[model samples]
Target: MTREFTTPPASAEPLAAPPSRTNRGLLICGALAGPVFVVTVAAQALTRDGFDLRRHPISLLTLGTLGWIQMSAFIVAGLLTAAYAIGLRRVLHPGPAGSWTPPLMGVFGLGLIVGGAFRPDPALGFPPGTPKGNADPMSWHGIVHAVAPPLAFAALVLACLVIVRRAVMLRQLGWATYSAATGVVALVLVAWPGQDGLSMRLAVAVTLAFAWTTMLAFRLLPPAG
Candidate 1:
């Protein structure tokens, strides 16, 4: 009897090992991070006694009697995102865009945790008790709080670009365009610090960025085999 050899079909990406339950759980956390954060911010922005998304940035929610709520939200979201990054490596590895994306995402997640740990100084008359025009002589923690978001945003933008490259390589023009748009728009929003609409702009940027992350996580989720 004669035996014949067969080969698998050609593809852009190599098939990854099947994901275990732990990895699936991590991806689920990644998917939930966006909703958990966006909802917390929206609900607090709408319900807080003096909070106003039009004027007060979401960071101010980390102040006052209800401060812990926002703080917890940030930390939780950060943890979820970090876990997702770990899971992302499993599926994205041995492929394009795998080198920098996961580390960048981890950096972004760390920034969130730092921002939560070091709350910004109350400003713009938020929490109904602070004077306007920023806190005087800014606290060290406040400075760290100020620095975290931009750094985090920068990392996210870089990660977006990396993914865009991957998408283009795979001939996924639509996904590439979407990733490019999200990255560029987010960068612009982060750079602009206008007094009139800073809060609104940041809110939109945050929602958009996290939405993209959630979408990416779902798209990369391994199939049942």
Candidate 2:
């Protein structure tokens, strides 16, 4: 006698539907946030008067006639980044990186929003007419602005560390190394001494962080298989 086994019904098997459009859109939004922020700030830096990229920080752009523009950019970037954090949560698996990255990114985004809302005081002779010095007496807003960046930077650094560990676990040695290096560079640049090239270093650090974030978002996309 011959025996045969019946195949399971299609419905009984796990459905393999394509990734939802909403998730795709959210991933794209997260990817675009960095470029949008960098380009907007670069444009403002080039056109705005008394805005010395070497001696002054981009946060100073949130002052004077065109202040609203940078302020809006900051808020927009932050919102996009926060949304991306949500997307990250949906896409990443329930592992070490997945557990840590989303929340850290959310904190980074929040720091951006808070920093933008509490605009930094005039310093390094920005806005064309301000005194050639730091924000004397340091208002509450200035203090908040000062604190926000370090907090955001710290979060991003931690996120990168998580990514590094995740990459190592996945056997992506190159990515692991890159993530570790990026974190180190960010930490060093943000802590650089003196005012010279501070803006450039900070810009580089922010760019590196966002570039890594965008790449990670792309990596987390569901495989086409």
Candidate 3:
């Protein structure tokens, strides 16, 4: 009788890493949240007369909460964007990826911060005649609000372009395509007439779109597969 060698059962430790399903879900949620917040803010701005911040203190309270959420979204998005950069660093030419990383993320983060400062609040209300504040020629917040979107868009555009280029070089077709599409959509949305225009309604819509896309892209960075 041949003595059959008994192989020990596999150890409890995983040999291969598990897929980041949870991470992916978190990313999707974050992305969706950004857009949702944007839509909420925009809706409020559009219906400013209807939204009495003073009478319904709850609504004011709600706006404050949403603002925090918006800020959180930016922080999360920046982190995710950084992670994507790291992944790209693994595959791309050292010099370009290295050079692009800091400034790209730096500006993106700056956009979020500045954008936060400029975010319109009907509750606080800007100087008279400046609807959405970004359209306000006289007020400083208006100018900041006006300029912030473009700056944020520029940063995003750069980051996305670099990622796409690196993806192309590395022959990462899927990653490249997605990055490019996201970048393009974001750029277009930010630069669109609605955003670029001085119209308050359009500006609000564009800003919302910007926030949404940024969140969506950032979330995808972690577990897009």
Candidate 4:
């Protein structure tokens, strides 16, 4: 008898595995973390008394009776970002990005958590009734908090560059350029000096950083097919 051959039905193709499904959910959390944190802080800045975005650092929101809101936002966003990094580590298997990006992302998340745990000292006339001058002889907690943003921002910047490295290896020049610019601009903004509108610069720098994170999450979230 002649051999008979049969093809499997279209619907019989294997579906996405469980870990992949979990990763999608986690990536979505990463994508949303930046927006949630920024929106929460922005809304508070607009409404809270003596909180001028042009003058005050966003961290100052973590002061006064309403400070708890910002602290919660920080911790929650950080946890979500950490989850995002974990998902990325599992799925970004094609390049060196898989090696470096996740750990840097984790560092950024941890920095945020630490920053939330220790609010920065009041300065530049924020929280109403506080002195317009800087917080001299700063509290131990405030000093610790001061270290978080720069460290977090630096980690995030490195993460951006790491993606660039992988993109270049894959010959994705446009993606590489975009990633490089994002990292460089954020670093420059954060490192810029001068008091005039320094607060606004910091705000913009952070927004750029967070926006990059959100967009990168979306870009990498497509499932393997």
Candidate 5:
């Protein structure tokens, strides 16, 4: 009997390459940024002398003998946030939301770094020796620090709006609503004029915004190969 020529099974198409190690690392960095920042600040707030969560800001922690610790925390958190922004750029689907969100977040991170580098003026009776109710005249660094947080907050709010659009596209109504609400609440809290609770309100605002950011990083994690 004549041997029939047999064709080898068609080679399977090559699988797509897995995500890069760099990408994974960036995602991890992003994921850790919020928690690291929150935890560091929380610890300092709880233990540091002359810190009043109701009257003084977390930023004021940059003024005392142990100020270096808070400053370092700010710098480190900013770097991690920037790294996550890169990962967002890579992982998000192409669109207006995707195009703008990463840059906005990147700005937020840069602002944090800049704000840390330029410490705020002593105000609201911090550092144990300053006047209890009077804020010092704005120093150059204080002016810069004052500007940075608002700018960063603006960028973060814009990014949240952009993310709302994307969430709607994904048919996630809850996320979309939450995103928009987060922005609105942050704006309200930040803009509130009551000095009595300003510190606490601002802390809440920061927590809400960064917590949203951290959640986003978790959402953007690439699927395991």
Candidate 6:
């Protein structure tokens, strides 16, 4: 009897791997930008009175350099945010309840961050009241640097929560889910109203929450197999 040789059946498709730590790191890098930029803007706003570029001279230059670094960080962070969002879209697939939601929210958040970066404001102080008498756009510092940017940042956090909720309900609380939820809570705390001691407590809470999300993002990227 002649036996016909046949090709072996193809192996079943490989199972998907878990997210890798490296990817987690990248995602964290992207997500952290939101908090960092928010804090920077806050710092600038709080110190406006003391931060005069003309009188401080060298100090002014230093501050300017720091500002550039913060801006650069935001850009890098935006790219990373986009990248992770795309990854989630892949796993979650197309649907209102899938991965797309969180990431899209993230993109919007990034927009707020990036856009805020472009907003101009007065160097530090300029008449303790709101703008008046047709002020120069360049001199519109406080609003641009403080309020608008943080609002944008808050938008991202809100987006993250909406997306993450779906994931949590679905029992798929991965890095993306955690990051989104934690970010939202953090932003909210940061924005809560209070002065002195209360402000410090809120700030700490926000920072810690964001930091947790960041840590997960860096540690829990989906694995490639």
RMSD of each: 3.2, 6.1, 9.5, 5.4, 7.2, 9.4
What is the TM-score (0 to 1) of candidate 1? 0.91
Local error of candidate 4 at residue 13 (angstroms) = 22
Per-residue lDDT, model 1, residue 14, is 34
Q: How much does candidate 5 score in TM-score? A: 0.88
Estimate the TM-score of every prediction: 0.91, 0.88, 0.49, 0.88, 0.88, 0.51
| Separate clash counts for every candidate | 0, 0, 0, 0, 0, 14
The Cα local distance difference test for each model comes to 0.86, 0.80, 0.48, 0.84, 0.82, 0.48
Q: Per-residue error at 151 for model 1, in Å?
A: 0.4
Task: Kindly list the per-residue Cα lDDT of model 6 for residues 35-56, writing each as its tens digit.
Answer: 6645664565456555432322
Give candidate 4's error at residue 67 in angstroms.
Answer: 0.8
lDDT of 6: 0.48
Please report how far candidate 6 places residue 187 from its true position, in Å: 4.2
Native-referenced Cα lDDT, model 5: 0.82
Instruction: Give the CA lDDT, 0 to 100, for residue 197 in model 1.
Output: 87
Candidate 4 per-residue lDDT, tens place, 1-225, comes to 899996644322122223366877888888999998999988998999889998898899999999999999889999999998887787674446887888899999998898899999889888899999889989999998999878988999999999898777767778789889999998988888878888888888888888989988877665554
Q: How many Å off is the CA of 20 in candidate 3?
A: 16
- Candidate maximizing lDDT: 1
Ranking by lDDT: 1, 4, 5, 2, 6, 3
Give the per-residue lDDT digits (tens) of candidate 2, residues 1-225.
999996644222111223566666666777887888889989988999878788778899898989998888888888888988887776664655777888999998888888779898887778787888887799999999899979988998999999888777767788789889989999999897986788889988988988887877676554332
lDDT of 6 at 95: 48
| Pairs of residues at least 3 apart in sequence or in different chains that clash in candidate 5 | none
Better of 3 and 6 by TM-score: 6
